[model samples]
Target: MRSSLIIIGFFASGVVLGLSGKLPNGFDFDKFGSYALYLLMFLAGLSIGSDKNSWSVLATHNYKIIWVPVTIIIGTLTGSALVSLILPSLTMKESMAVGAGFGYYSLSSVFITQLHSHSLGVTALLSNIFREVFTLLATPILVSYFGNLAGIASGGATAMDTTLPVISKYSGKSYAIIAVFSGIVLTILVPFLVTFILS
Candidate 1:
């Protein structure tokens, strides 16, 4: 229900943007969108931060859960490598940088747009947007079957921050600990990973 509402809201905003011709003119959104993303990221940080016990559980658990993130990284690397291979001349670093954007669409789109030009920015933005949506929809099913680790990874990088509530909802209290840990680790890794892959 919340996801549906979010999707609806975005769709409505898209309509408004189209009708008003008020789409962001440059890499930056009008102040409102920019602030909203910042707030969202901050909220994610706050949510995860407030839950210290989750981290303790993660440390206590057999580190087997680590594989969940490892698989996610591997998937990311494989996708980046394949894209680079197909593009041939595109270096591994560049592909990985693109991959590191890792579905953190809003900021990635803004930065990529500003740095690389609008087209690549749009690609980054759209891919991140889709990844978020995909993760949102997939969370329940993944948690039910593949378990919390897989569910968290399904959100890819967004799991670090924005997707916690959803993960918590589906995966239960224990998942919160994992979610916080995942969020921090991924948040720290995203920029470096993207740079490493892209550069």
Candidate 2:
């Protein structure tokens, strides 16, 4: 909990500093945040890259991993959609935004904020935080019962960052594949997904 706070604090501080005009003139803090995200992904790749066995397994039996992501995506969509329907005020697109929390909060929030408004970003941030907390709390139990995919889905996009260690420890080496795949796919999907939702 403390460590998580520290990590989030750093990013949050960056936002504050950015807003305060502490960053160099003409240097976009938002763009810096995006670059930082990529760097984190690169480091995650390095960590996973060090494990040859995991990489080999991913290369050989990649199809098996897809089921996990498919299940997670379906679950997120269902959960968010159900919540939206129950509320009756939220739109389907808003529901989808809420459901995508598998660590996608920052990017999604930033995207929504830039394209739409701060309110949408705020919604995305809060929902994503909820999603991540749920993932962290349920990781041990879910890893035992629902398996790696559920665990991965719990962390959402975070499986590629600081949460990767937790995932590697709890879900085993196999999940590294899912983490990398989800991260890469999500990274690419961000712009497209946001555009679709905004439109």
Candidate 3:
């Protein structure tokens, strides 16, 4: 929640800077952005790999439930592909990359910005952020109509942390396991998926 707001603020600040034409001259933004992207990816990997609990969460989970995240990914990518055919603004690769973000806006947007263009990165950021926000705001209605797992699916990569509390409240404590499991799996896949699609 707070992080989303902070990202929006940063994006808005960047837009303001660009509009003001105050960016420093003679600096290679492409080179700097590439380095920054590499650093962010490294740090993200380090943070996850260093956390023993992250692996433990996966290791201890029932393998049967793995299908949940798998299904989410398939559905997301499928929808993205279909949308690509409909919307001329995005190609199949671009749409797939955007969908690959799931709900991990920060990491995915950075990857897209580097691998694709800033415009596509902004689209990924908005779409992914909306995924999380929709889950947070509509969990109850989602769970009520579409069932408990619907909330989990809507939560996407945020199910494990940001949307977990709401999901727990509406979907019952039993489903929290599935939510966290799917969230972690999707979060882990975001960078790999985006890079793969963009490549």
Q: Which candidate is the best by lDDT?
A: 3
Q: Rank the candidates by lDDT, best first.
A: 3, 2, 1
Better of 1 and 3 by lDDT: 3
Report lDDT (Cα) of residue 197, candidate 3.
86
lDDT of each: 0.67, 0.67, 0.90
TM-score winner, 1 or 3: 3
Q: Per-candidate TM vs. native? A: 0.61, 0.66, 0.96
* TM-score between model 3 and native: 0.96
Q: Which run of 10 residues does model 3 get worst, by summed lDDT?
A: 56-65
Give lDDT tens digits, candidate 1, residues 76-147.
Answer: 778877887787655665566566676776556655544455566566666777777788788898877886
lDDT of 3 by residue, 1-199 (tens): 9988998999899899989998788988889999998898898889889988678878975777898899999999999999999889789999999989988998888889999898998899999999999989999998889887988998889999999999999999999988888999899999889888888
Per-residue error for 54 in candidate 1, Å, reads 12
Ranking of models by TM-score: 3, 2, 1
Residues 31-122 of candidate 2 have per-residue lDDT tens digits of: 67667756755665575568665455446566766665566667777777778877776787876765664566666766666666666677
Model 1 ranges with Cα > 4 A deviation: 1-67, 83-95
How much is the lDDT of residue 161 in candidate 1? 59
